[model samples]
Structures are given as structure tokens and as C-alpha cells.
Target: MQELAERAGISGRTLRHYHQIGLLEPDRVGSNGYRYYGADAVSRLQRILLLRETGMPLADIAGVLDATTTPAAETEALTGHLEHLAQERAALDRRIKAVEHTLSMRRQGREPRMDVMLEGFNDRYEEEVVERWGRDAFDASNQWWHGKSVQQQKEWKARADALLARWREILQDGHEMDSAKAQEHAAVHVEWFKEIPGTPTHAGDTAKSVDMIRGLADQYETNPDFHVAFGTQEAARFAASALRLRVRRLEPSSADDLRG
Candidate 1:
């Protein structure tokens, strides 16, 4: 047990807790009553750690592990997760490079260009957009966004800010989730999403459209960015619940696809 714990860089107490929760277990017990984990256990621990790195909850990880019976299935899931991690790393690298470039300019008493200053942020958003949608989707959307003039970009941002403010106004007024007023706002929300180019909504694929909306609704509730966008996590959660209800009405058979 101590060896396994050291190898995994986790405390024995955590190992015991995992055992208690049935998330992991020792392969056998010695005659002296010490628990032992074999190579299989070590391999399983690797999978557990990998899934945890993806921010999956322990319960959900267990479900996924249980469901992934074949080696190919496990490989496929891990491969996708690896791609996401690689993109994240690339974005972080870009940020580091941008900051280094800025610092070098500062030492020479030079001001960075607007685009150069924002390069890291653009890369970060690009990575996220590509991961959530697809490379082609990101390409089209990125082109459309930068295609706009500065004034046009600001105006678009103003409209988006207005939409968020309206959402807050409705929530502050104590409107019930899935109520008539909430549903009306949901329609408005869907239309706002439709305005974005290269999204599933504008792709003319019904299933993907449903999926995109559902994914956004899920993110609004569980993603920290949305929590900040909505002024509070509670508000985001409420909006997500309402959106989920409204979207379900629009597509009755669309199921939840929360990632594990």
C-alpha cells in the first residue's frame, strides 16, 4: 500500500478513502494483513488519474470506466482527452510567448501593437472554440468575427451585453423557470445563438443544432466562465435549467450528453 501510494504520489489515506468508496481497491491482502496492488491495479489507477485530469467526478469516472469494457473504447476516450490537453498546452504556450515578447518590448521602451497584446487571448479563445465545435467551424467563425470593423465589433458586443442584461433582469424579477416569460426569453436566446456564423444552429443539421444548444445550456450551469458571465453561479444554473426545459420542448428526444 505504501509503495503504491508513493508511486501514485497520493496519500495512503486517500487510497483508503478510494477503497472505502469502491472507486479503487487492492488486488489482494498479504498474510500480515497489508493490502497489495498488482500491475492491473496500477494500470487502473492510471486510468483513474487520467479521467480526473479531465475534471470528471469520481462517480462519473466510475460509470465511464465500467462502460468502457474494451481496450479500443478506452483508447478512443483517452485519445480525445489527449487532444484537448494538447490544445490547452498550446494555448498556454502562446500566452507565455506573448508575455515574453511584451516584456522584451517594454525593456526597449516600445509599446506592443493591439493585436500583438491580445494574441494570447485570441489563441485561448480559438483553442476553446475549436475544441467545443470543430476546426472548420472555428475557421469560419474566426474569419467572420475579424472581418467586422472595430465599430461593428463593439456594436455586436453591445448587443450581446444587452441580451445578458435582459436575462439578468428577468431572473431578478423572480420569474419561474420554464414559465411563459422564461420561454419567451429562451426563444430570444436561441435566436441570439442563431446569429453566430458556423455554429450548429446555422449548419442546418437538426441533431447537431440540438446538441450545440444542449451543450451550451450545460456549460451555462456548470462552467465557471458562464457563472461569471451571468453574475453568479446560481443565476447561470437557473438559466441553464430554463434553457434545458425550453430546448427539450423544441426537441423531445434529445438526451443529456454531459461529459464524463
Candidate 2:
């Protein structure tokens, strides 16, 4: 058991916890009370670790594994997981290179470029994009982003940054969520969301667009990345509140339904 844990780079306690939760079981236990894991157990552990990286809960992962019976099924599952890891690795590589270039520029007494800083950040909400929209929506937007020249990407990012800055300024000016100015800005924000190639907004699916806006409003209030982007937690929360109001207006008939 200790050897298996060491091999997997996880502690024995974690493996034991998995055992206690019925998520994993040792192949056998010695009379002296040590646990042993066989090859099948090791393979299961690998899958568990990979699925967890995708933010899946342990219960869902157990169900997924339990349903995957054949060698071919295991291979298919691993292939999908590998693709997700590759996408994340590519994003990380771009961000790393961007930071490295910025460091080099700073050492040479040059200002780091904002456009260069925005590279690879296009995939920041891949999980949310996939969950709210679909894999096709994510792939379409990803393709749209990568197809842009560095200059074009920078221009798009500049518009997005300006919009967020506007939100921050509005909140700083003490605009209430239901205030006229705040509601106007929220409407503009919804229109801006349609600029993306593959979203419910761009597709003109008003109902889906309202749903997407609601989900994103929740994210803005909860996600720390939005806090940093909006320049403060207060601004993020305000943006979320304003967005919720805009969506409710968009779907007045569903306002009561959305309250829960």
C-alpha cells in the first residue's frame, strides 16, 4: 500500500481515505494488517486522478469508472482525458511564455505589453463554456480565437478590458444595481457578449442567453478571477447584481422562476 501510494505521488492516508469511502479497495490484506494493491487497482487509481482534474466529484468518477467495462472503453476514456490535459497544457505553456517575455522586457527596462499579457487567457473559462453551452461552442470559440492574429487578439482583449474598467468605474461611482445607468451598462454588456462567435447570445437564443447570463452572474460573484478582472470584489458583486437585473428584464415572465 505504501509503495503504491509513493508510486502515485499521493500519500498513504489518501489511499486509505479512498478505501474508507468505498471509492477504492485493496486487492488483499495481509494477516499482519498491511494492505496490498494489484495491477487493476493501480490502473483504477490512475483514472481516478485524471477524472478529478476535470473537477468531477469522486462519486461521479466512481460511477464513470464502474460503467467503463472493457479494455477498449478504458482506452477511450483515457484518450478523452488526455485531450483535456493537452488543452490545459497548451494554455499553461502560452501563459508561461507570456510571463517569461514580460520578465525579459522588464529586465531590459521596457514596458510589458498588455496584448502580450492577454495571450492564452482566451480559454480561462473553458469548463464554464462547455458546461453552459456545449463542446461545439467551446471548440468554435477556441478556433475563432486561435485564428486571430496577435494584433487582432490584442484588440479584442482591449475592448474586453475597457468594458470591465467601465464596470469598475460605474460601481466606484456608487451606482445602485437597479439604477438607470447601471441597467444601461448591463444591457451593453449583454450585447458585448454576442461578439463572441459561438455563444447563446450570438446564436440569438434569447432564452438560452438569459440562462447563460444568470450562470455568469453567479460566477462573477463567486469566482476570484472575476474579482481580479473587475479590480475589486465589490465591483464583481455589483456587476453580478446588475447582470441579474438585466436578465430578469430580458425574460420578465421567468423572473419569479429565476429567483430560486
Candidate 3:
């Protein structure tokens, strides 16, 4: 157990907790009551760590692991995780470069341009966008955003702010989740995503579009920035629930051909 824990860069106590939660278990127990893990355990731990890095909950990771019964399936999942990590690394590199440029500007007693600031901010999630969709997805969106005139950008922000205000009002009105008015707002919410240049929804990739919408809903529920922007945690949660229901109504498929 100690060896596996060290190999996994986690403490023995964490491994024990994982066992307690049934997220992971040793291959066998020795006669002396010691925990033992084998090569299979190492592989499983690798998968667990990779999925954990992707921000998947332990329960969700367990489900994914359980569903990966064949070697082929496991390989496919691992490949996908690796690609995501690579995208994240690339995005982080861009963010680092942006920060460096900002520092240089400050040293020169010059403020960075608005475009530079937005570039850094947008690049902050470039890798995440790439991982969620692909490089072309990020590139297309980035180009579209950067190509906009200052007036257009202001208009876009105003529109977004207005939409958020409507969401806040809806939550404050205490409308039930299943209300027609709420569903109408939810439909507008989904439509908003379709305007993005690189999203699967924009490309009409139904499966990936639904998946992306569902993921964004999860983020809106749990992300602190989203909570602050949306008025309250409860409001964000309500919005997430509504978005999830809307996405579920989309055609279901495992296909993710929105690589571009």
C-alpha cells in the first residue's frame, strides 16, 4: 500500500480513504493483513489520477472505470485523457507568455493594451476549449472574437449582461423549474451557446453539443466565478438544473466528431 501510494504521489491514508469509498482497492490482502497491489493496481491508479485531473468526481470516475471492461476501451479512454492534458499544457504555456508580456509592459511603465489583456484572458482556457472540442474550435472562436470591432465587443458584452440580468430576475421571481416561463428561458440559454463560433452546437454536432452544454451547466453550478456572476449559488444551481434538462432533450449519442 505504501509503495503504491508513493508511486501514485498520494499518501497511504488517501489510499485507505479511497478503499473506504470503494473508489480503489488492493488486489489482495496478505496473511499478515497487509494490503498488496499489483501491476493492474498501478494501471487502475493511473486511470484514476488522469480522470481526477480532468475534474471528474470520484463517483463519475468509478462509473467510467467500471464501464471500461475491455483493453481496447481502456486504451481509448487513456488516449483521450492524454490529449486533454496536452491541450491544457499548451494553453498554460500561452497564458505564461501573456503574463510575461504584461510584466514587460509594466516594467516599461506602459499599460498593456485592452486587446492584449483580452488575449491573455481568452487564452487562459484555450487548452480547455481544445480539449473539450479541438484546436480548430479554439482557433475559430478566438479569430471571431479578435476580429470584432471595439463597438461590436461592447455590444456583445451588453447583450450578455442583459441575458444574465434576465436569469437573475427569473430566479428572484421564484418560478418553478418546470414552469413554461422557466423552460422558455432555458431554451434561450441553449440558443446563446449556439452563437459561439467553435462550439459543437454552432457546428450542429448534436452529441458533442449536448455534452458541452451539460459540462457548462456543471461549471455554472460549482464554479465560484459563475455563482458571483449569476447572483447566488442557489440561482446558479437552478440555472444548471434547467440547462441540464434542456441538453438532455437534445439527441443522445456518444459521437464527438466536432474535432475542428
Q: Write the per-residue lDDT of candidate 2 for residues 66-172, one digit (tens) a residue.
A: 87576565466667767877877877877798689889989999866443122222466667778777888887767777778889978877888888788899988
* Over 4 Å off, model 1: 1-133, 252-260
TM-score of 1: 0.49
> How would you encode candidate 3's per-residue C-alpha lDDT over 1-260 as one tens digit per residue?
98888978999998888888988888998999778988887888898898788765688678778885776665666677677777677667657867998899899998653331122226667778787778988888776775688799888877766665677788789887667777788878767766778877778788777777787788778877677667678877888887777666544532332222
Provide the lowest-lDDT 10-residue window in model 2.
113-122
| All candidates in order of TM-score, best leading | 2, 3, 1
The TM-score of candidate 3 is 0.52
- Clashes (backbone N, CA, C under 3 Å), per candidate, total 0, 0, 0
TM-score of each: 0.49, 0.52, 0.52
Kindly report which residue pairs in candidate 1 clash with one another: none
Tens digits of per-residue lDDT for model 1, 1-260? 99989989989998888788888889988899788999988888888988888865688677667776776666676676677778677657657877997898899998643331112124546787677677887777655665678799788777866765666778888998877888888777777766666776656555776777777788777867666667777777877888788777877542332110
Q: Of the candidates shown, which would achieve the greatest lDDT relative to the real structure?
A: 2
Error of 1 at 249 (Å): 0.5
Worst 10 residues of 1 by lDDT: 112-121
Off by over 4 Å in 3: 1-121, 252-260
Q: Is candidate 1 or candidate 2 better by TM-score?
A: 2
Residue-level lDDT for 206 in candidate 2: 73
List per-prediction Cα lDDT, in the order shown. Answer: 0.71, 0.77, 0.73
